[model samples]
Target: MKKEPIIIGIESSCDDTGVSIIKNRNILSNIILHQEIHKKYGGVVPELASRLHDVNITKAVNKAIFSAKIRRHEIDAVAFTLGPGLIGPLLVGASFAKSFSIGLGVPLLTVNHVQAHILSHFIQDANLNKDYCPKFPFLGLIVSGGHTQIIKVNDFFKMKILGSTLDDSVGEAFDKIARMLGFYYPGGPMIEYFSQNGNNKKFTFSKPTVSGLDFSFSGFKSDVLQFIKNESRKDSFFIKKNLSDICASIQKIISEILLDKVKKAILKTGIFRIALSGGVSANHEIRRAFMALSKGNKKYEVFILKKKYTTDNGAMIAIVGSLKYKRNLFDSVHVSPYSKFKTF
Candidate 1:
């Protein structure tokens, strides 16, 4: 029997350094080392992130290989996130991946970070969701700290951006709003937790009027800031008294804006199958909203990656690597990490 090729995936796109190994679409092992120091600053510090990645990459990769119980010779190729992230972080992972590939005399694959998030759904699952998979010609919502986009995925490599944010991403809005509420860095989960018991209609924020499927959240964020400022001046303890309500209202408006665009994309593409990816997809309210929307319409089918793969992770990178490797898509040795890149 021919042995399936084993591939190594490395990710250092932001604050986490991740490594994973996969064969035949099955994830053998996946590991992620998060930079916790950034929490003190309420957001990722690029230099700190890159420094931590440098410290963690080697150990992360070694652990992944050991957990996979694979010898160095078993890895057929190496894949790494190459763009659309902090240049320093990208370089850390890209450099490591290139060195590993050369040392192993294996092929190299450079993955687009955002595209990897969309492909994450294809990662092998050994649990109850093992058989779950979405067909082609679907809408993909990419929501993370750095990006918010609606993509029409016609095939593995054929994709079209239906819409994109003109300013802040959904995750950014969550974090920024959470900051306004005096929450720590990475406030998405905190906001979601508080929103559960609050009235979502307690506050109203104007949505952007961008034509077509494009989005604009900068104005929404500014409105939120202004609202909080005005309310605080009226009542010194306004935020303390209405934290839950504020969270609920903010989450509700963001969810509506995102789904509204998805609705538009559906009409434009005539596709009923939609998938949600990126870190923000982990938000309970957003997940619920997407699922509810799909259930309300018999024609809609929504796909969301497992919580583990929802964030920046190497499993997504590995899955994309495996797919590209099958088609002999390999990167040259001289390929460099890019700070900015676009996916079709």
Candidate 2:
């Protein structure tokens, strides 16, 4: 029997420095070093993020190797996220990957950040039930800090974007709204936590009138801003007093917007298999809505990644590396990292 190839994936697309070692589809070790320095700023600073990645990349790689219990020489390939992220961070990861692969005499692979998020479902781990993995030709909803899109996945490499956000992505809307409510950076989780104690219907926001499967969160965000401003003028303590209710209302609307587009994608494509990916996929409300949609109608089969994999991580990148390795797809040493979104 042929031995499975061991691959190392490096992800420094943004604030997190993630490194992972995988044997085929099975993850052996996944390490993510998050940069908390951006919290004070309420958003990621590109320069700071890149500098931190430079500082953390080597340590992250070493830790991953130690945790995986593998020698550096045993790695068959090195993969790194190459696009749709901060250029500085992307360069940091890409340069490290190239150097690492050269040192190990292994092939180098470049992964699209968005593609890794979607393919994360294929990572075989204890947390993921093998039977729940989506087959080919599934509809993929990728909602992250930088991107939001509905894609038609025909195969591992063949994906077509059916619709995407016209303005702000859902994740951005959540963070901005959270800021308005005086939450810390990465406000999605914080909002979800507070929403549990509040009523989702306490307040109503106007949903965007986007046509087709496309999404528009900018208008929704503006509505929330204006409402908060108006209410706060009347009573300075309005936001402080109704924080939970506000969070719940905003969470519900965002989740509904996402689900509405997903439902449209399903109906238009006639595909019942739905898969969710990216950072926002970890939101409790979004997951709950998707699960409810699936359970309410038996015709829909929903696949969601474990919470750990839902965020930006190297395991997702490693899984894509393993797939590309099998087809002898490798990157040239002179390959450059891109900041704009590009299809794989």
Candidate 3:
């Protein structure tokens, strides 16, 4: 077998500062250093994220390279997140990657942060042959706090977003609902934990009305707010007592909404392979519902990224960059960070 090139990935698009070293499909080392400052703000503060990235990037890169047991000169290319993130943070990561690439005289591949999330599936379950991960022209669903969309992966570096959220992404919905229920700042997990004992049927919310394979979570979020307001009039502690059931129901509705879009994409495209990524994909109900649907079809294969890889991290960035760099895919150093979504 031919030896694969070593690709170093740097991710500072968000709160976590990540560094990963990938050699072909194999990950030698992935180091992530998180910032706890955002916990007080109930979410990521852009300015703080940028500052921390500047501080952590150096430590993360050194640690990752050291852990991988590879010399800096041995690295074949440098990979970094380019856009769809906080500008300052993205710049920090991008600048570092560009400088490193230039210094090493190796190629630098700038990766789309969201696309990297989907590609995360490629690195997480490396044990699985590429076949199980899905081939080109498959459907991909990316659901996170900041994004939600279904894209067609025509090829590794070629893609087209088929559908996206009109308002809030699924992850954002989860966070909003969690907060309204008196959950903490980052309450997605709390909602999930409390949802275990709740009855999904107790509360019925409207599913988003999206015609063209897209998604809309703002309406559902509105419904959640109305439901809480109406219930609170009856008893201030109603949610506290019925938190589990409410969470279960809310989670179920959101999962179904997302699955509906994926179903539409698959039916329209005639592609059976599907992948689920992003922070919200970590939800157990979403994973189970998606798995059940995929299992029913002989032509369908499903892949859900691991919890660690689902969140913003350099591993996904590194993996995507490695694949793209090997194919001679390099973005201009002038590529700037984009605050909104971008289609491939």
Candidate 4:
């Protein structure tokens, strides 16, 4: 039998430090260490995130290797998220990955953060529903704290941005709106949880009209703020009394806005295969809406990542790494990290 190649993936692109080990198409272990220091600040502190990555990268890698029961020498290649993130955090992971790969005498793979999120759909896991694996030439919807885009994915590395936010990503909008509603930091989950019990129709917010597939959440975010401010003046307890409903309404509007563009993209591309990725994909409301869009439609198929890979993680990076490895794509040791890099 041919030996399966082992790959190590490291991701410290932002607030979380992650390490994962994958052998062939199967993941052996994935370890993530989230930075809690930024919670008190209501968002990620770049410098603090970098410091935490420095502290945890080694530990995270060790834990992943230990959990996988694999020797460091067994890894054939090292992959790390290369760009489109905070420079500090990116440098931390990039520096560590380059040094480690050189020390191991293995080739290094650089992964684009956004591309990894979309490619994460291909990561094989025994626990995931096979129906969630999307085929090639699909429509990819990436929603996260830092990015929101509708992409046409033709192949492993061939992705074209059909539409992207002009300002304020979907996850950022969710967090900011949740903050206005008296929620704590990292409010996406809180908003999602509370939205379940609330009536989505109880409150209605204006949606922005953007031409084509491109999105503009800044205007919508402003509308949300203004609506809450005006309503709170009429009744000081308005937010408290309608917290659930407000959350539901917010989620409903956001989902609609996102899906509207997706609907347009589908119309434009004539591709029925749809895939959802990134942190915001964890929103149950959005996921349900996407699933509903595909249900009973013989021409439509929808795929979503497992909740674990929705956020910043090493597994996604490793999956991309494995794909690149097959193509003999490797990065030079002199490569550097960047806060912003195009996915294409």
Candidate-wise lDDT, in order: 0.90, 0.91, 0.85, 0.90
Which clashing pairs does model 4 show?
none
Clashing pairs in 2: none
In model 3, where do residues sit more than 4 Å from their true spots?
A: 124-131
Q: Residue 23 in candidate 1 has what lDDT?
A: 95
Residue 119, model 4, lDDT: 90
Index of the highest-lDDT prediction: 2
Give me candidate 1's TM-score against the actual structure: 0.97
| lDDT digits (tens) for residues 1-344 of candidate 2 | 98999999999999999999999688999999999999999999999999999999999999999999999988999999988899999999998999999999999999999999999988885233345579899999999999999999999999999999999988898899889888999888889999989989999999999999899999999999999999999999998899889999998999898898988998899999989999999888888899898789889889988899988999999999999999999889899999989876
| lDDT of candidate 3 over 295-343, digit per residue (tens) | 7876778887667777888789889987887678877767776766677
Off by over 4 Å in 2: 126-130
Give residue 155's error in model 4 in angstroms.
0.7
**Candidate 3 lowest-lDDT run of ten:** 124-133
Error of 4 at 244 (Å): 0.3
lDDT of 4: 0.90
Clashes of 3: 3
TM-score for all models, in order of appearance: 0.97, 0.98, 0.95, 0.98
Model 1 gets an lDDT of: 0.90
